[model samples]
Every structure is written in structure tokens, then in C-alpha cells.
Target: MVNDPHALHHRLVDRPRLTGLAFAPDGTRLVASVQTLDDEGTRYVPELWEVDPAGERDARLVTGSRRGDFAPAFAADGTLLFLSDRDPQDPPGPALWALPGNGEADRIAHHPGGLTAFAAASRASTLAWTAALMPGAKDPDTHAALLHERDRARVTAVLYEATPTRADGMDLGPAEPHTFVLRGDAPPVDAGAQGLAGAGDMALSPDGSLVAYTRAPTSTAPDTNVVVIADASTGEERRTFSRPGHQYYVPAFTADGTRLICQRLREETYDSEWQVTLVALDPESGEETDLLPDFDNWPWPGRVLPSPVPGDTTLWFTGDERGHRPVFRRDPDGTVTRLTASGAYTSLCVTPDGTGLYALRSALDSPPRAVRLDAGKPDQEPVLLRAPGDLGPLPGTLTEVRTTGDDGFGLRAWLVVPEDTGPGNPAPLLVEAHGGPQGSWSDWPWQWNPWPFVARGYAVLLPDPALSSGYGQRMQERGRGQYGGRPYRDVIALTDAALARDDLDAGRTALAGWSYGGYLANCAATRTDRFRALVSHAGLWNLEAFEGETDMHTYFREIFGDPRTRRERYEADSPHLDAENLMTPMLIVHSGKDYRVPTSQSMALHHDLRRQGVPAKFLYFPEEGHGIDAPNHLRLVYETALNFLDHHVRGEEWRRPGLL
Candidate 1:
């Protein structure tokens, strides 16, 4: 029942993680991937667990293995299919495995480069998955031979003639991913290469006659993906659905198979805020209709979960609203119904009859848990089906704070007050900024959980500023070209509003952020020294360096313009230029492998702060990425961050974290 940071961390890391959920054809059984730490606690092993959706029986372990198994899909014939890294153990690569509802799992199909993603058609009993294909290899056999030869010869060098030679959390590729199809007991068929950027958001037709996938036209412009519908049997392109400046993905065919419904992002400019809309396309006529024409909220809310509700024209999706992610259902007539009142939902799945909806719900005080939604009664509380992780009681109470920024825009923030905080004993405030500069702090963040800080008797403020999504398009435009302008002001304005409350202590405040939040933290340090302490994790300090080194160079150039040509935006918004004004004692955390906001940004900031005699400490994780994922590394991150705040904000003696 412990609620402290260390205890919470231990509980979180050791708990069985549930994800990748799928329901059987009869809707009687639901399958989910359960991930648990290995005996040594170095890594995670995934197993498939079957549970009765009716909650009549206890969850049963369907598949037990030390190897990682995930991406569960049920075939039309009641066969359970999943991707596993089981046998031929030396070099582990995912292969398709099947369970016949009452027998041992059997390998159904294998790939040379390992499966990345897969989708199965319930009616057609067909399977499609994406796998990497080696350069110059025409078939899987050739690809496998090339891999074997490379392993034998110890050939590790990768020659990239593409725009992105390196990617975060992946090896530099000599092999490009392509989709493949597998029919019952038949030779696997190549559905064709999805350009150099690989395939994503693959959806198969109910009859298994057509395969719809999204891929970039060129390797240089990976962000500009277009949906392509092709024949599953012959691998022949039938139709290409795309607009000149828009990106389309997540194509799902209607149950009747007349139209393809998916998400479309209007490509205005690299720097401009793109509007995501639900669009339905008549596969025959090529006419596209904006389903939710007036819906301004971003449809793809939270992590990239399953958005489309199968077997009906009605689609269930999530959108951000006033610091909450709520579920919304769009009828075939284009009428949108707001389902859940509050809280964030993801990994959405609807029952076969379309009457019942299921998803994982979470909030500021709760971790993700499986819940069944009453589609008819939109306001009803979701029935909690299961929660694998043991998220003990909250150490604080959660509330919202609202204020209008200097620009007349309404700003909203979530305030977490420690249980001990009140009028008699106000708690120190920690104003935490969210990343995405374009993203909102709405969902339950498992990786960057705020419970640790709340457990430490500090009140945490999470604000949605100008550039945050789910607020209308106008809100996004507020901080578009200017990074430090309205967004920074909105954060400060919200913080001030929160501090006005009797329960929050304003005098002992601190600012902390990661990624874009990190960028804002840097911006805050330069703009004002009101806060006693500041922490920036993988934050962007130099605009010029970030544009050049970031993976999305074209996107950055579109927003800020080229540093060489659009010099004004960079000079005006960059936090590094105002380094001389920084007076707050800072803690800079960065990972060597953070390609998006390269480690160089942190290095530059740390060096500048030290040179300017501004007290600063640098915590570097050489083996980590943009976000810390390793259990030990995550624990150390929280410990160090809390210690930094305790020293500067709470005026406690500094104690270095053991690893540091």
C-alpha cells in the first residue's frame, strides 16, 4: 500500500503490463498482451492472456513463453494469431504463431527480417504483416540468405543513400520494411515494398480482396504519407487516395466495403498546425467527405491506439478537451456524440454488435485499466474490467485551474495537490510543462508519471498552453512561429492563477519540462527568474542546431523557416540567444541517443550556464534515448529530479543520486 516514489517505482516496474488487446469473433473472450520483467529485471517478456469480457471468469494465461509475444489477432475460423520471437533462438525475429483455441501454439508463418506490424481479416481468414527486406533482395529467401551471409562475415556497416540514415531506437537500416500476405497453407505473397520509408496503418478488406496501406512517395519526405489500396491476391495497385498537400493514414473499409474511412492531415506548411479530420472516401468514385466537419478537437488523441471501430459506419475516437481526453462517437450521418464525460481513453475496441465499446481509461490519479463503455448511455461510468498494474492510492488530490492568457485565450491546467497541503500548510508548487510544443498534457503518462512528485509532498501543475492540441485550431496557431511568445506566457499565467489558491505555495515554485516542455523550461529560465529551480530534459536550447540535427528537418524548416533565410523567427524565439538573462539554478538532463532534440542542445546549454556562472548540473544517460525507458534509468531520473527540486526549491541540503 506504499505510495512513495521508490515504492511506486518498484510496484510499477514489477507489475504485469497489459496491452495489444483483441476480441474473439464470438466476443466472448478478449486477448491482451501481458508484459512482465524477466527474473534478472533487465528486460520484459510478453505473453498472451485471455479474459472473459463479461467478467464472469478470472483471466487465464493463454500462452506462456520467455520470448516476447504481441500483436494478437483472431482469425475468422476462431484461431488466435500473434507475433512471437520464439524458436531459432540465436537471432530473435518475430514469426506468426497460431493457437487453435485448445492446443499448443504453432508457427504459422516466418519472415527473414522479422514482423513489425500485422493485421488480420475476420471474414477472409487472411493475414498481412510488415517485414524488412534487404537491399537488392527480391524475395524472403534471398533476404534470409543475405542476413545469414552478413552475420557470418560480420558485415555491420550500413550505407544509407536516403535522407534519414539513422533513426531513434533502431539500427541504421540496410533493410527496408515491406508488407507481406499469408493465406492458409499457401506460399507467402509479397504485397510489394512500401517505398523506402516502410509501411504503416495497414488495413485489410472484410473479404480480404484488398489491402490498404500508407507509405511516403519518397524517402526524403517521410511525413507526407498517402494511402494506397491494392489487390491482396495479385499485389496490383487498384487506387491511390491522396491530396496534393495532405497526409492520409489508418484506412479501414466500412463493413459493407463501399467506402474507406481513415484520418487525413491537411498539410498546410511545415511549421503550421495541421488539422486532423476523419474522412470517408468512396473507393469507386474517389469522392471524399469530411465526416466530422465541425469537430475541431484532434481525433487521434493519446498514444497511437486503434481509432476505427470495426463492423459499423459509426466510429469511436478520442479527442482532447479542457485538459481531458474524452471519447467521441461519430454516427454515419456525421453527427458526433461525446461519449465519456472525462478522463483519457485509448486502445479502443468495439463489440461485434457495435453496442458495447471497450478501451483503457486513465487519469491524473489512475493508471490505465480496461473498461467497457455503454454506447447508448454516453454519460455512464465505464465498467472497469481489469487493471494489471497495481497503482496504489493517490498521494494527492487532482483538480483543474483555468485562466486567460495575456492574449485573451483561455488556458487550462491540471493541479495535483499533495494530501498534506491546505490553507494551514501550503505545498510547494512544481509547474511541469508538457512536451510537443504542439502536444497537450492530457493522458496518464506511464513513463513520466507525476505521482512521484505528488508523493513527495509537492503540488504539480500541468498546463495546456497555446500550442497544445485538442483546443481549437486558433489555440494551436497562438504559438506557431514564435516559441517563447504566447505559449510561455500562457504557462506563467496559468501558474500564477494556480498559485493564487490558498493550498499552493507560490514562493517555493520550480519549473520542469521534457522535450518541447524542456524547450519551454529553457524559455522560462531566460524570460524570468521567478522560479527558484528549473529542470530541462532533452530540451531544445539552440534553434539553429536543432533544425539541422533533428530527424524532422523539413518540418522544422517549414515552421521556423530556414535559419539562413527565415532568420528572424529563429533569432526572436531561440532561448540560447537569451542565455545571459538566465539566473535560475538549473538541472539539465539529456540522453546521447535523443535524435529529435540532439544531446548537443543540452551540452551547449550546460556549457553556457557554467560559463555564465549560473549554477547548473548535467545528468547524461549515454545509452538512453529521447525518453528514459530502462527501469533503473527511470528510477534514477525521478530520484535525481526530486533531489534537484528539494535542494533549490525546498531549500534542503543537496544529495547526489547514487548512480550520478
Candidate 2:
């Protein structure tokens, strides 16, 4: 049997995954990087595309092909700077490149190693990108190998600029690497230190005196703090007040350079507690003012919301508190106004002058599209910048159902039924779980996700079980430290209710999830014989092993209780302990380089399943991290999962044989 799910010639497929959006310096235009999933599954030819804020025409593709190009930003002089993986020298990783605003493009320079983050310098033609250059090759299988090599990989942030007379090109001449020391490691040299572990966002004050970025320890917890102001010249820093319980992210500076705005995390919940409040920070005095109402939480590092009104205390940011992050305007005095009320926005960026806001919006039914919101006239409707030809229309008649699980907990979920519903026609059911036992499944759009399940004649059920964010504080706390217990019961009960409906095919039921969802899939397999098949991407099977193997171990006690003190409790709840009960056939996929849920968890599950003579197959991805990073990997994952489900659920003979 064929292992690839896309093997079926007429099957509907979602080949392109869109993410990483940015706006031109002037804000009149925007660019985004999109991942395409074709019949081949996953391939990364991150195409850079341009869109006008006014949805006058479709977005135009800027970069072409799988050689890879993404993360585009226009310089003050109108030169576009973006990251490309076309470096034959680097073997499929990111490198800095430049293009004339008119579309002429050429490579600038290769990164020192893995180019993790890149931001163009404000006012100047200079650009900066983060790199991690390892000392030597180490096996990715062992934790010691990863730790040793990761430690050996000296990280440094470097600034690069095209030489003079190169407005149309990147002059790789003047490249300078900035260095720093670990807290107690050295004499604090500014060159050779890991400044920000996960520094994906960066902002420069208009005056160019101060730079703001998010700093989170890569090997530690996901918590972050905002580093507000740093002398761009000397690297000396001043921080905003320590948000005691919050991890500050995406600290942005206003044009005047006096006030800084940032996104701060307030509380940890599976859902809505994370917010994007417009905070005002005095760069010099380190004082802060909350200029926006405490609204539903948003992801850290505020999205460059609608452009900031020059000299006005009002700024724009996105938060899901009111639902899925509709763009909101926050005035200095703390009045919040909604800008776009229709679909959920994933990314937002404002122009420097504050006259216009460029945003990307996608619904559970569609792929992301670019739009321009004019703050100058609030009543003006958003202009659709670009909509791809491939983006299919959303499903018809979606329903949000509220049902009580057997545990008596009120479970909220979305039910996407086929339009052809009729008597004696039961649709197959696919239960999709969200990761981040701390993460929630929202009413957000699903392009490469849920929509695909629905498109394939499967009734998709996405439940916001206890620990989801939208409801409030209490609901989110219900699942903490209760993994594989009440939460799993809530899901099982939900499934039972769905199965009771005559329109759902109970005999053809399947379960799928990523990250924490991965853990839950394992939980469902061992917990009950309800599902006919299971698909776990970047999933975890062993908790005791994960506690010490993951980067988030610092908070293990907070989420799963202390493993040492509660060994029996941890073991009792772990999927590894229940492996013998995992009667449903399962397929496991993981990235070799994933640090969050390291590959070993999958390895552990595979080894145990093999020893027990269970039906299972494990696919390992090379050159990828916790998530699917390339088209090839994504293709392999999707195809394997779909085929696996087809085999067990539909009684299709398994084509690709499993190791077991």
C-alpha cells in the first residue's frame, strides 16, 4: 500500500501553509511568506508576495520556487530586504538577501550558521540577523548530543550593510557581529552572547536611538520579558519595569522615542487570558502606563496593529479576548475600539506615519488574505489587498454546539457537517485536538488544518475542553496538572455525544493532534477503544521521559505536578504506561530537531509498541524542529496520517508496511 495520503488522484488537498507577514516601511504595501502543500505533501518554497493595503487586486508573488524566499521588509530607501534559503552554500536554511523596490533581486550574504531572526536597521541601509554556528556535528538522537552541540553552537547577532553605491543591491562588505556573555560566563563581551533566545520580533524607535525586542531563554521556559530600550550604538540597556507575573513581548517604540508599547502576558491559561495591552513605557525613567483596557489575551509581542497616530497616544494591536483577535484601537486614556469585526487576524503591521494599517485575515473556512485598514477614516471598509486563486470558499453551515461531557463539565465545540446531510448518510468523524495543553482551539480559520478534514467528507469536531482560553480563568485551570484524567474524559464524552448523532459514522472515527494534542492522542488510544485510528504529529507518548527531555521542564510541576514527588501519579497518567491498551492502529511523526517535545518521546512510543506487537509506524524528519519545517516533511506527515486513518478506519488494507 502507498504511504502517501496525497496518492489519491482526485482527493482535495491543502498544499500551501501561509505565515510570517510583514509590511513595507511606508505601510502602503505588505508582504507575507506562504508554505505550499501540494500533492507531494510539504515543500518549502516560501514565496514572498506583495499586496496593496486597498484590496484593489490580488497579492503578487515576489519570490519564486522552493529554493526558498521569505520575510520581506522595505528599507527607508525603498530597497526590500528578505530572508532566502536558496543558499547552495548553506544547504536549505535562511540567508539574507536584498531586492530593489522595483523587483530586481540578488543574494547579499550567507549567515554564520542558522539565521534565526533578521531585521533591517531603521533610517540606515544596515540589516541584522541572528545566527547559531555550531562547533561540531553531534548525533541528534541523544539529549547529551543536542545539549553539547547546542551549547557548543556559539550564537551571535550580526549587523550587515551594503557598501555605498548599492541602493539597488546588497553590498556584503561591512558585516559586524555583535556579541555578549552569559549571566556569569564571561567579562560581558557584547560580541558572542545569545541576546534573545526566541527573538522573532524586533522594533526600532523612529529616532533610531533605542531598539526594543523580546528576550526568552531558549533552553528554559517559554516565559518572556520585554527589554525596552537599548543604546543602538553601545548595546547598553535599560529595561521597563519587571512585569512580575508577566512575560513581556514585542516591545515597540513610538515615533518620538519617548514612549514604548508592548504586549504583556498576564496569566497562564489554556486560552483567553493572554492579552495585547497597549503599554506605555518611559525609556529613560523605566516607568510604564497601561494605555489600553485589559481585554481578552493575545499572543506576546504585539502585532504591529493599525499604525500608531503620530503624537497621539492611540495605537493598534490584536487580541482574542473579544473572540479571535479582531484588530482593536487603544487610545492613551484606555478606550478600546474594534477595527475589523469579521474574520480573525493572525498578523498586523502599521505604517510608520500611522495613517494606514496593513493586516492579514483568514477565517476557519479560508486561507489568509491581505487587507488594509484606514485609521484616518474608521468608517471606511477594509480594502482587500490580495486573495489567492487557490483559496477555496469556506464550508457551508458551520455550527457551534455546547454539550456536557460525562464528567458534567460543559464542553464547547465546533461541528462542521457536510452540506449533503440526509437520512442514512453518516459522515466520518475526525476529532482534532489543539496542542499546548496550554493552547486552545479557537473559532479561527483553518486552511491547512480543520477545513481539510471537512473537505474530505469528515465531520470535524474541535472542542474547547477545560483549559481552553475563551471562557475565562476558571475553565482554563481545570486541566492543569490533570492530564489524562478529567480532561480526557471530557473529550471521550464529547466523542460519545457526537457518535450518538445518526449523521456521524461511529465505525469510522479517528483522532489527531500536535504537541499536547499528540499527548492526548496517545491518551485516547490507551484510554478507550473508541477511535478506530490515530495520527499524532510531533506528539509525546512518555511523560516521565518528556519531563526531563523538553525545554519547558522548568514548568513541568506547574502543569503535570513534580515528577519526583508524584512518580506514581505521573506514571499512572502517562500514555507509556497504557501502551498495552492502545488497540487502535497509530501513526507517529516527529521532527528530529524538535526541542520542545524532543524526538525521543516518539522513539519511546515506537519502541514499546514494537515490543508489544502493536500496529504502529514512526517517521523521523531530518533538518526540522518541533514543527514540520519543510514541504517534504509536511507531505510525508500528511500523507502518512491520512493513509493510516484510511487503513484502520475504512478497513483499507495498509499499503506501506510498519516496522512492527
Which of the numbered candidates is closest to the native, going by highest lDDT?
1
Question: Please, what are the lDDT tens digits per residue for candidate 1 over residues 579-604?
Answer: 88988999999998888889999999
Q: Model 2, range 491-529, lDDT digits (tens) per residue?
A: 777777777788888888998888878888888877777
Candidate 1 residue 584 Cα shift, in angstroms, is 1.2
lDDT of 1 at 395: 80
Q: Give the lowest summed-lDDT range of ten residues in model 1.
A: 300-309
- In order, the Cα lDDT scores of the candidates are 0.78, 0.60
Q: What's the C-alpha lDDT at position 282 in model 1?
A: 77
Candidate 1 local Cα displacement, residue 486, angstroms:
0.8
N/CA/C clash count, model 2: 37
TM-score of 1: 0.95
The deviation in Å at residue 239 for candidate 2 is 4.2
**Residue 625 CA displacement from its true place in model 2, Å:** 3.2
